[model samples]
Target: MKMTDPTTSAATPDEELSALVMQISSLSKLALDMTKVCIDVKDKLPHVIAAQAAKIAMAIPETGETVSTPWFEFLDAPTPEEMAARYPSTNGDGQNYHVVCAGRRPGLYADPDDATAQVTGVPNYVREKRKGRFEALRFYKAVYREGRAFTAIDVIVSDDDDE
Candidate 1:
């Protein structure tokens, strides 16, 4: 059984089989290495993608200007006094005059007739006074009753620090 260079000399059956086995073994190892590399890449892909996205977000656009939506302005919370002034009561009876419901329940609607109506959920507000300044934290639901108005009824105010 002669084992010579495959390109130059003819090899015996046993030699050919041995060469084929060696090639298969080498190819198997290469395939395993490639699989490991792919696995490692897959594991790190999310972080790499996130970093790239962050970079893209921070980067200036080709037009050198950034665009924003106007609706985002509504998300800003107005001061308590400002909120009251903005949503004045319609009727002469100023019972719940600029009341705004600040409850956590979503899709909760406010009633215009009853000031203390519990339709959606209990209204909740947190009032804190520091250094003679009072700050009230609550959510306001704007309703279109007797014109546009804000109501804070049915909301509960938690004054834990009130002595």
Candidate 2:
């Protein structure tokens, strides 16, 4: 971020605020370019297809029309993180997309100590964010060693929670 003195500048106070807004906008765009893939899309499409196949193959037949098409994919609702990446970030201070703890009853959790569970692919964070309801984001510092990824977490700050 560039630092500028308001004292000497001919620009008005409103102009300075606007300048700050523009800088924040640019920073957010750059952040999206850097982290969109891992945050926005994490191979959920493949899983969707696989789940559909499992559904169709099961003993109980689905009454809905047999699935097939590009259109069908769009119907699969995009996650809020995906929307956040694609949608413009008005404020640069939104939240980190990676290492999200969301789903049912989202909150910080103690690192799981189970070795067998660790061997199986499991995210340390649990998501409780309901579909169509994106509450907040969680940030993390990660370390990979001994065939596992460990993280230190920081949750997005919220006023609603305080209320």
The segments of candidate 1 whose C-alpha lies over 4 angstroms from its true place after superposition are 1-10, 61-163
| Whole-model lDDT values for every prediction | 0.38, 0.36
Best by TM-score: 1
Per-residue lDDT tens digits for candidate 1, residues 66-108, read 4441111111134445654654444433222323332221222
lDDT of 2 by residue, 92-146 (tens): 4334322223221222222333322222332232322222213332221111111
TM-scores of the candidates are 0.32, 0.21
Worst 10 residues of 1 by lDDT: 128-137
